[model samples]
Target: MILEIIIEEMSKIVSTIPYLVKYKKHRLTLDDLSTLANDSWLNDQVINMYGELIMESADSKVHFLNSFFHKQLMDKGYEGVKRWTKQVDLFSKRLLLVPVHLEVHWCLVTADFLKKTVILYDSQGIGLQKVARNIVKYLLKEAKEKKQSAFEMGWTVSSNEEIPQQTNENDCGVFILEYSRCLALSEPLHFLQKDTPKIRKRIYKELCDRTLHKKG
Candidate 1:
């Protein structure tokens, strides 16, 4: 339920941030933007560009698909009808960009049946829990329209010993979320390491809440 809510809320939030930042860059809310500034991984300029991309192509299917797939669909079809299909795939890839960036795993059973899973690594350094929380919020909001279900399942914040030093990649403060019956996940999923402020903020908020509420 939390995951679903987060996903839905975040979609709305991210959709709006780009426009707000474009015309109201100077007047943009610091508190809202602060959530994006975690360590050196993300900055104001990066955030602005990120928001711009989302804003400029908000209605475009290409942007939407890219966000969902997490990988650009390669054009591989003959001219005419085949080319038209390829173009559709490209649009899908773009539209799915944000969703895919946030989601690490996604699968589709049919045109409308889908499932998605997400894994946030290096969460401790930045603030992944908040990001996860936001995603849940967004999902929850969308569930009503999409008739979907979401589950936080479990989270694992790994330490050095948990992941060998020579593991090639860092794995600290990692968290996972699983989703079912999602329309966005009805396609091949791909991995992207690009920075997504909207997702980062949502996960950060979730983590902060969990940490603050801990019994200690």
Candidate 2:
């Protein structure tokens, strides 16, 4: 019976049943869920949807940047995303999660305000020094524009290569989401490449339920 249920869901997923879930301001279509089911590269919608779930499950001090925020900043600089935080104060948040899509891969950049550190978590074990630098520069300009002062407090920019690395090309998205999920909950990044399939299913179920299941 469990196998039948799995096959049924997979059939519906491949049939492309239009939109499947709507959480907050984001709506995820069949295409998005299909990516998760087939172990394919996840797109902006899937990343942002899962990100919202992470924000909801995280502490009040946590903040999540929309998936597009990184690309906007990269393409147009601070001016592009300057108005993004008009209502919310990012500096006030303890952790800021930035999901980055580099056309071919997905990675996470987390800003730890309390620790004054910026770390890149890439599943493929690649480093993105420029991403951290640009984010630090954005924070400084944001402070000047919003807080009316220089954010001169030095920040350490580094990459965490010790985290689980993806062995397959398609699991990078799953890995980053797992990275963000673990960080949001203050859990250690201990999951492995072998765990991607299970993690992917859990994420899909969480998305369907419109709530992230806490790690047990």
Best by lDDT: 2
lDDT (CA) per prediction: 0.29, 0.82
Positional deviation of 170 in candidate 2, in angstroms? 0.7
Local accuracy of candidate 1 as per-residue lDDT tens digits, 1-216: 333444555566656454223333322343433434433233333333343333333344322222222223212212212322343333123222232232332211111112233232232233234443433333343343333333223322221112111111221111111111011233222212332333354433433232111111
lDDT (10s digit) by residue, model 2, range 1-216: 323334566566645555667888898876677787655787888888888888887756788888889899989999999999998887778799988888898888999988879999888877978987888888888878876363556778999878899888899888889999888888898898888777888888888889998665
lDDT of 1 at 35: 32
For model 1 the local lDDT of residue 194 reads: 39
Lowest-sum lDDT 10-residue window in model 1: 173-182
